[model samples]
Every structure is written in C-alpha cells, then in structure tokens.
Target: MGVHYVEGDLTPEAAAKVERLGYTAVWIAGTREPRLTIVERVLAATGALAVATGIVNIWYAEAQAVADTYHRLEAAYPGRFLLGIGAGHRELGTDFRSPYQALVDYLDVLDESGVPKQRRVLAALGPRVLKLAAERSAGAHPFLVTPEYTRRARELVGPDALLAVRLEVVHCGVEAASPNRAPARRH
Candidate 1:
C-alpha cells in the first residue's frame, strides 16, 4: 500500500525508509508549498516508486512556475513525478471567484508549456470537474472521500483515467479503553 505525507513533513531519509518498506507511491499533500525542493530530495532518495503531488492549488500559484518544475523533475527522474492540480478552498474575497474557469485557464498554460496531459492529474469533487479531468488530464485526485465517492468518480472519469486519493491518518496515543481518554460525544 502507498502512504501520504504533507510537504516538508517527511525527510528524504524517512521517505527512503517508506520506499524500502514497500510503499508503492508517496502522495504529497498540501498546496503551494514553499519548499518544493523537498520533493526533489525525496525523489533522489527513492529508487522506483512514484511521487505525486496530492495537489497544487491554482488560486495560490502561477501555472508557468508549476510547469517549469514539472519539466525539471521529469527531465531528472523521468516518470517518477506526477503533477496534481486543484482549485483550493480559501477566503480570498475577490481572488477566488470562478474556480472552474480558473482551472481551465491554468491547464491552457500547462498545455502551451508542454506538460503532457498524462503526467498530470486533477483534484475533483464534482461531476463536471471530474469529467474535465478525464478528458483533459490523466485522472482525478480526490481528497477525504468515501468508497461511494470513488465509485462515482470512476464512473465520471471513465475506466481509463487514474484516481489518487489523499488519505490523512490521525494517530492518538491514548488507548480507547483508558480512563484518560476523552469520552465520545454524540449528537
């Protein structure tokens, strides 16, 4: 099975360990991280596993820069890198409008920059975006979704497209049966 880590959370050595322990891919979560170099470090350390960005938020970043990075990584590591793009949620009052159109325009830039469609994925939650992802890019990368959502996404994207889900695991050290544990609250 594959695992995920937020950008800058896993060091290169730790990533190497993850690969050694038989994880297939490393999905990097978070948007527009300042330390894009960390991804390169992880790529350098691992042998053959795929390293994918869970998403790079279009609203917070320029497409050209992202395309440049994609090219550079592809040149260095071949098929090891996959670029995932998304229209992220934010409180940018005026800047966040028309997310669907923004995503389309961003893809235009990536196209002109020659970042192949197969090398990229899209973070889609709804039918329209999922359809766009399948038609224009490699596949869909959905976050925090259920099995039913996966089923729907597959149907929307068709059988040929890829699907990468962001899975965040929270670990609490306190035992469930322990008195120290907080009581469960019900609605």
Candidate 2:
C-alpha cells in the first residue's frame, strides 16, 4: 500500500520526497494524463518506491503505445513500476458496447504487444470483474473504496490476486473536505 494520490506532474525532486515519506508506492491517475514519463521521473528520483498508473484509460492509449512505454519503463526500472489499466467510466460516453468485453480485448492487445500479465493490474471493483482480473491480470486496483469493500474484493479476487486499494485523504480545511466523503457504493 502507498499514498493514494501521487500528483502525476510532480517534479522528480518532490516525487522523491514522497518516496522518502515511507510510502511503499505512488499511484498516479493516468487517464487524465499520460503517466509513463511521470513514472520514469519518479523512478529516477527514488530507489525503492514503486510507481503505478492508478488507471490508464484503455480507450485513450492504444495497446502498442502502452506496451512500448511499459517495456521501456520496465527495462529502465525493473520491478519498480506496475501498470494499472481500466475501461473507464460509461459516463465518459465512449461508444463501446460492453466494458468487460473491451477490457478483454484490451488485455488481448496488451498480450499480443508483449506486455506480461504479471506486470499489470486491472482497475476493477465488482465480483465478476475481480474474478476476471484474477484470471487475466496480476490483480485489481480498486478506487474510492472502504476497508470493508477491500475485504470483499479480496474475497472475490481469491487468495492470489493482489488487492491494491487507492485511498484518497484530503488534507484541507475540515469543512471544505468533510463533504467529500464517498457515499457507500451499492453492488
């Protein structure tokens, strides 16, 4: 586990400071910004901290591009980087018919492009998806979740699948942040 939100644009020096703060890993949301460069910068800055793309939107980056960047980072940083990818929200209104199918397709592309399953994880939450993650990728990276959900996710993912939870902690004015608490998710 590590700090929930690692600003993707952090300077190498500041990212190193984050590493020095005892966080085992730093998760940068890659959907909004391409993260391979940031991962490299952070890895260059710190010797031990793992860098993970919290969730690289599958629809945005092609499999070849993802694989190329992944291979480049792995070659440079070894086991210090983990690729977490997802199909993204339906609200974004992508025309894809089925997210699960798209994910499977994306994984197929990733595999064909030479990205090993062990080096990647899926941004999954529900049981079916968690099961798919366990069978296909290294594990699941769940966002906006509670400890109870983490426990359930672990159960659904089985014993071997890595269950990484992305927790957001807001260090702002009390009143300004209290309302940011995530409501309990249903199913």
Alpha-carbon RMSD, each predicted model: 3.6, 4.6
The residue-by-residue lDDT of candidate 2 on 97-166, one tens digit each, is 6888888988898889888889899999888789989999999999888888988998898888888887
Best by TM-score: 1
What TM-score would you give candidate 1 relative to the actual structure?
Answer: 0.86
* Tens-digit lDDT string for candidate 1 (89-169): 755636755888999999999999999999999999999999999998999999988778888888899999988865444
* TM-scores for the candidates: 0.86, 0.82
Q: Which ten residues in a row have the lowest lDDT in candidate 2?
A: 178-187
In model 1, where do residues sit more than 4 Å from their true spots? Answer: 33-35, 92-94, 167-187
Off by over 4 Å in 2: 6-9, 32-35, 90-94, 168-187
